[model samples]
Target: MTDDARARGLTRMQEVYGWKPPEIDGAFFATTVDHLFAEIWSRPGLSDRDRRLLLLGALTAQGRMETAEIQIHGALHNKEMSEEQLREIALFLCHYVGWPNGTRLDTAISTVTARVRDGGEPRMRRLK
Candidate 1:
């Protein structure tokens, strides 16, 4: 198990969608980055699939589709999740969170899936 999968304070915060700070300070950036991917993510309590779902829910609840797609792709890549699951999550979010939020999530998911189907990088995806 790597530290990226752990749940120290900052790590857990980054696991959440839209937690990025306006400016990057070396210590704060590394600390939060590690905390999200390592400490909290390191816990075995949640499966990768479930983690994706949780992030979907969080993004929807927060109405932040911009950051949500990263987790969406991460979910798809990590757990081999299908678009249907992402769609379902968007739908579920509509009920608990709000219709407007769901719409945004749906749009983001749809756009990502469209690009993927076209064999292009999803818009939210960063090129390496």
Candidate 2:
């Protein structure tokens, strides 16, 4: 990938996820930044808000709460979604995804929302 593409993706990734991988994983991280963020995410078919919502649903359904937390924070940070919108999404998914999955999603959303309300910085850490 071009330097410009990688740099742009890195900036966007940092804006959304709050952190980037270390140099130790530079190759993999570069690929992620170059292809996933720059190429795929830049596609015009979906708005950033729409992409975030899709990711939120998939992560929630898979019980990937940690990753989902970061996405939730991004949604709120970017004003792509409101607290009420998130709450409604959780409630609406309950019937389709089942109570257990929905409950976990709700808990994750509540935790992130509370942290944001308290003026705490978004939690950041290395991805596994």
Candidate 3:
């Protein structure tokens, strides 16, 4: 990948996720920065918030609240969404994705929001 793509990806990563990723070596990481963040996320049509909502839905549908929590944390940290709004999304999604997944999302919203409010580091960083 071009240095420009990597640079832009890191910048867009901070803008979208509210943190910088540590340097890592892997084809997955390369594609993530070079393509996902640099190209898809930085694309013009959808705002970051819009993309975040879509990601949340997909993650929830896939029973991936652990991953969803990162998005939730970023949304709360960056002021892209309010706790109430996220709660409402959980309720709305329940009918579509199933109650279990919705509940999982609600739990993640609570956990991530509390951490964000309490000035805790994002769980993703802690995991690393």
Misplaced by over 4 Å in model 3 are 125-128
Candidate 1 stretches with Cα past 4 Å from truth are: 1-25, 121-128
Q: Model 2 — which ten-residue stretch has the worst lDDT?
A: 16-25
Q: Which wins on lDDT, candidate 1 or candidate 3?
A: 3
Per-model lDDT: 0.65, 0.80, 0.89
lDDT of 1 by residue, 35-80 (tens): 6555666677877667777777887899888778777655554445
Q: Model 3, range 42-67, lDDT digits (tens) per residue? A: 88998888999999999999999888
- Pick the winner on lDDT between candidates 2 and 3: 3
lDDT of 1: 0.65
